[model samples]
Target: MTLLLSGVDSFTGIHPFLLVLAAAGLDRLVGDPRWCLHPVVVMGWWIRRLQQLSERWAGDRPWALRLAGGVITALLVGGSGGAGWLLEQWALGRGLSDLRPAGLLALWIALTSALAGRSLEQAVRSVLQALPDVAAARTALSWIVGRDTTELNQAEIVRAAAETASENAVDGLFAPLFWMLVGAGLWSVGYGGAPGPLALAWGFKAASTLDSMLGYRQGTLLWLGTAGARLDDLLVWLPCRLVALSLPLATGCGPGGCLQGLVAALRDGVPDPSPNAGVSQAAYAHAAGVQLGGLNRYGDQLKVKPLLAAGSPRPNPAAVERMLRLSLRLELLWLLAGLALGIAISAVGSVQ
Candidate 1:
């Protein structure tokens, strides 16, 4: 415990909670800068390059394509963690104490890029800004959601944007921090500057980027995307549930309401077919008392997903805005939880 905190202090030159607060602050204030070489952008380029190379090498065989895809997924996902691990090693070993401030600055920048809170808010807000103009809304929605926004009504657009903000809140914020804390705990147990947490976070980012780029039914990548899609689902499963269950507490909806929200989520979210996305989306819908899913066009095909708030008030722009605010609150809630855990760990150490 002391060892873990000490390792965190050694690595970042600050306490773990402070480190988390700093990272969160940076995420809120400075979203992915257009100027910086974002890690996700780097991963995206790598994925595209691998896709081109693999397609040529694997020929037309379905099995060969799938095999090549699995290899690419493994390499990128594992390599993301390995790269972060190597950076931590380099920073700790070769970087001089006189260079500590520079090292910390670099890490801060890297960690800031890991989160997508403000950027996501901006995305939803973009659609909201383009409102009443269906053409404009569709264009803005295209930037955030995978759905074909051609036939969507204003209410449908609002619901879709809210659902996206809810779902991404887990992927973009909660899960990464959970993994980082785990790695920090591991370091305290005699592991030297446990690189596992940051590695896992970035690795999740890599898998998510791959899934986004390749996981589509109507493409040459249908088979190739299977590994990325499945790996992303696997990585996010637990964190999805955690965020879903915590939504009530985070939003201060009270215990009975929380239980009601969870039950509604399980009842409705269970049938959405997605393992992880449903939980958060459903929880958000139930907690906010707004209907979410319905029939939607991905392209020429129509998907009739389960309606979340059946016979209830539909989400308007105000509700969608509130959902966005809830997403920000969720980040702060996790920070408080992290601080409490640190306090508990320190207390136990003192008793020992």
Candidate 2:
């Protein structure tokens, strides 16, 4: 297990934890630069291209669409993961001692691109900034959420923005962080040329991208999108729960209060159809002392969600701002915790 520390040094000239921290900092400084071709945009293009091909091949047959979708999911996820592994190997081969500055920069940029904390915050804040003016707010909110915003009032706009911010805390931030750590742990155990951090992070991103684009219940997407949707749900499950448990504590709550918060979040979140979304939203709802989850419109359908933090007031602009702040604080907390764990692992490996 000497590889824990030594391999990290050789691979990136620093600890993976530090790389992640730097990447997150970079993301905050410059979110998905508008001038450049973002990786997720490329990923979305590929998904659309593949969907066209799949539709042509599968025709209208339900089983055929399902099969085609499964194949597409496998290919996209596998290809994304494989690309990450190859890029890492090519960049850091024979270790960073060789002093490949371009390679190191590339790795940092890739890592930064994978994280969406800043981007998500910016989007939500855009909606918040458009507040009180229902038309302007709806226009801004339309860009971030799937709900019909045309009929939404100011309070509903605030609730929708709050919900988007909370739920995406899992998708846009925590899940990628969790996978990168997992991959780093695996690499330290002597798994060379395996996923490692970047590969696993990109892979999770690919799955998330798939679900966001194709995972719908309407028409052909019902069957054709199942593979991507389920894969995203599976990948996000552990991270979502981790966020639910830790997010409350990050709010400066005492141990007993943290436990109560988790219990309350779970009690309310469990009833939502999504395994992860409910818990995440509920966690933030309770932490912010605001209610979330209510009627939402997706295209032509209107759906009602179970109320979380039932006795609390509906989220206002203030509550939404608090939730965003909480997200930022929680991110810092997780980064510190991950760095501590990495150090502990390295120390244990040194002893061995």
> What are the per-residue Cα lDDT tens digits for candidate 2 across 66-126?
9988988998899888788766666656554653578778988998899988899899989
Q: Over 4 Å off in model 2, which ranges?
A: 1-9, 12-14
Would you list the C-alpha lDDT of every candidate in the order shown?
0.76, 0.85
Steric overlap count per candidate: 1, 0
Q: Per-candidate TM vs. native?
A: 0.90, 0.94
lDDT of 1: 0.76
- Once superposed on the true structure, which residue ranges of model 1 sit more than 4 Å away at CA? 1-14, 92-99, 188-190, 255-257
lDDT of 1 by residue, 57-119 (tens): 887778888999899999999999877765544444422342356556766667677788888
Worst 10 residues of 2 by lDDT: 4-13
Cα error, candidate 1, residue 138 (Å):
2.0
